[model samples]
Target chain A: MTNRWTDGPGPRLRDVSEDELLAQIFPLLPRGGPVVVAPGDDTALVRTAYGSVLATTDTMVRGRDWLDEWSSPADVGGKSVAQNVADIASMGGRATALLVTLVADPETPVAWVLDFAAGLGAAAAEIEVPIAGGDLSSAPAGTLMVSITALGDVDGDPVLRSGARGGDVVAVAGTLGRSAAGFVLLQQDRADDDEDLVREHVRPRPPYEQGPVARSAGATAMIDLSDGLVRDAGRVAAASGVRLELSTELLRADLDRLTGVLDDDAALGCVLTGGEEHSLLACFPPEVALPDGWRRIGQVGAGEGVTVDGRPRSGGGWDHFHP
Target chain B: MTNRWTDGPGPRLRDVSEDELLAQIFPLLPRGGPVVVAPGDDTALVRTAYGSVLATTDTMVRGRDWLDEWSSPADVGGKSVAQNVADIASMGGRATALLVTLVADPETPVAWVLDFAAGLGAAAAEIEVPIAGGDLSSAPAGTLMVSITALGDVDGDPVLRSGARGGDVVAVAGTLGRSAAGFVLLQQDRADDDEDLVREHVRPRPPYEQGPVARSAGATAMIDLSDGLVRDAGRVAAASGVRLELSTELLRADLDRLTGVLDDDAALGCVLTGGEEHSLLACFPPEVALPDGWRRIGQVGAGEGVTVDGRPRSGGGWDHFHP
Candidate 1:
């Protein structure tokens, strides 16, 4: 779906007007009730229901992660916030706030920076978290590096990566491989100026609230789909001391979604190895009823490696450096 | 005081390890209460007097802020933690925890990453805070970016940059221009290998607790000396709509501390324009007695801009992007 507010290309960097992106995303966020103050403030205020607060930060450098021509400043900003927020989500906690640090080259216009900020603000608002504070600097090359820290409140207990049991049901919420499909689309769009795939490449719609939902659903193991399903699932498998097996038949729908749009090999590859969809992946007891928006993909067993249709998969997911 | 840890010459990147550096700096950190879990854990956990949490983050990139030859990875890590913690302190809060994100080229040795982590761990420990979580990524160029997010707790009311009153007395905790002086020393050190100044350039000793102390002492406004004194102080002066003036005599001791050790003009310039010392610059009501470890440096009045001895000064501060 096209975003009406951010649809048209406007004036050049210096002349473009400012639109409040935070206002758009703020109302979309899932409230955990622990947030004392949400976005649109100097800093977000969150109450720790238990003993302490958990925080983590990450940065995505433009040239390293995406090309400027393919991703707009807003897309860059949104992904930056989404990825960092996913880190917090992986811990089975709701993100309360975020702080962004940006570094751009001199040629990057003020409008680009503002648009980036708007995207970040919108993302934070969508998550019901605030853009608490940030810092800005100039880089030597035509590079843009965005660093974000996501703060979350640990309610009664934090669901750690080491918590899954042997017999838990591994499941996922939101679509997989779409981002990977979108990424390929982006590359092709860059070459041919194909608008459809270009849009998907620029913005991967992540299931933001699914994390908390899965957590509340008694998930024993949790992760965010950042580095493809197989790779991230492997992390859970390795961390939880259990083998995870995905059913190819169960993933047919996802594969079908990309069938006509992507090449056969590329479509399969995107589902197996795509990154940055920000979907929630979790493992729960076999008896638990799966929540809406969640699809059962795999099951946990008494082994270590992740498997596809009871067999070992060859390719590992996306690696920022290696990719 | 030469650091025995880094004494060896000639391509020591592989030989010198982070464990060795961490062992040296670990004992220097403040030990005891409020620190539930420290640096060795996947994430640090700290208890807050108040149930709520406050967090902020910032990142510094190489070439944009410092040169690698002059400063070690550990120094970069320490500065990252120190600066973010200072922001918490500015809010009249105590840092409970921190999370760091580091991006470096793959060619950057694992030892360097560890040392950087060690420095970050040491800085957090010094403030009785811990490194709760972190992310490591690879950069395309020979650049190092360090981002730190600090979680703080509000004891009562948060001291804001916008709260200074017209009649407040401006004061400072800790030395000013030392980092800047160290920077000059580092430049000379690069040219002539001046070891003395170079050491100061690496690990800056910020007055970590001064923020809370100033707040309790009835500070109306406060900020950290991340930027040079003039520039940061000017923020308060501008925000509070009050002119701030420094007593040159009060800063004489700080000046004398670096005298004979620096070139005349360079020394003055460093003291006036240096950044990243992380000292506390705050304003309090006229009736409040200055806290111990703090010196009265100036007074707030009905005017604009920062002044030295009732006269305006120029070219004596650092701006992150402008510089």
Candidate 2:
């Protein structure tokens, strides 16, 4: 209590009321997206295309999700937006708008809030999705969290995760293992030498536009690689009741890109076990042609869980509590 | 950390992986609303009505927003849904769906999460809005939180707070002072004696249908009383650029209802300064016939701010970081 607001230390959220904080952040919000009625209301009105709209929500908690020393406020905002938007893309829809909620301690710096807003604004601008409306509240001491809810519009019918079957080709439309490599680089204190790899861990760039592209090209099943390629693909495999046969040869391409950044085993592990990549992993009918940015990495088969080069990868990644 | 999920103590989240946790909670979700694609995917596809939809989000942090001793897990879940849904109602829309996120310690009980889900499910069932999609992540030890994003549909144009103008009559369709009085009752251990007041604090039932009723009755402006009557009325006044002249004579009726529960001054203060009531406060042209359950309380004029009994009340209600 004898800190920030009292000028005893750093800047504090308690110095200004929640109303004042929202007003300050209002000017920084982007209005370029499909917002019919902007913020500062009980609820924001947004435009959706068809009768069906896709929705998803995710959260990032400090200490558990990120450390302030390693990540800028902008990085937190961008990562939150990237992960949520990728969920919409995985649904074969366009991310239209987002409603965000930030919970912080009273001692949290105003600069951090503003920087987070900047990242959120930049991400929204990059994807053309508006920050429609959100809530701000204080959390228990020593805790700061950001939660985002993303809304999306589908073209016709949504491509679901349960649609993959035998004889389908598995493909990916974005980079993989970069985030994991970045994590390892950060762990090894090589972030300065490997800026791009570190950036991947701090701020993910998902192939959002490729979602609808895959849908248009008849993607049978799709998912976002938020929980690693093997685990997330296992989700699709379980949901579709089809075995996912992943090829280590096909995955070598991802590892090749990580050659100098990490060792062979680590690169391969990162490609298969890294989470938060936000890459689009999908399955398409064998006859369907793969679109640009999408490369065949595996195939859908008649058996059980995921296998890399005919070997089971039960060595999953990122267990929330246990980790 | 020694609690749930351990063999010697109890059930802990670490006992099951995130996938197992989701599977257990999925059956507890209510799918009564317009859900096209269900959970267990990257995102959920929901059916919308028109080209436009309403969106809002809110968060509740444990020990800061509520006390575990006073509120059950179900109460937290129900209250979270109630407040967010009320935001959509204030915009003159019907809430259609919600996406929820929960962050808790890995040592937290499985029963707590399941009970929270049950409360969320019951609330969704009560309002008929599907629990479309959600995320669960681990938090730092001893910290637990729940955040909700609500989606709503308007018939056509929404009733916004900025639309109130001169010669408009101000009215409300729900009760006030009950929640704040309930808060006091809980603090004093008077909750058992005043069951209704405690229930009011634990579970607020906002008059949702009355929102469209006001809109259909040609209401010009509207706001939800989440920040108390005086503060929220100030918002309407500031947004509409009008003086909101609240009649103490009219508020006497609200205060009168609290006579048996609280003192005169406390009741009046509660009616004027209590937040989280979620009552619909609106303005309609003088000619519009007042709908049932709606009662006139004041008038709008070419002025600024809010006045109670012809005097300015500069005092406001709840500040997130301060109060």
DockQ of 1: 0.10
Q: Put down candidate 2 lDDT per residue, A75-153, tens digits, no spaces.
A: 9999999988898788788876776788877656555665677787788777667655566777767778999988777
Which predicted model would earn the best DockQ?
2
What's the true lDDT of residue B75 in model 1? 77
| Tens-digit per-residue lDDT, B1-323, candidate 1 | 33221222332212323344234323423322333434331122334442456666677888877666666767777777777777777767777656566676655554455556667767666666644545656676666677777777757666766567777888888877777776775665452444545555567767778888988988888878776888788878777777888777777877887777776666666666677777888888989999997888888878788888888875354344455
Which regions of candidate 2 fall more than 4 Å away from where they truly are? A1-50, B1-50
Q: Distance from true position, residue A301, model 2, in Å?
A: 1.7
Q: What is the C-alpha lDDT of each candidate?
A: 0.66, 0.76
TM-score of chain B of each: 0.79, 0.83
List the DockQ of the predictions in order: 0.10, 0.12
* TM value for model 2: 0.84
Weakest 10 consecutive residues, lDDT, candidate 1 chain B? B4-13
TM-score of 1: 0.79
lDDT score, residue B108, model 1? 53
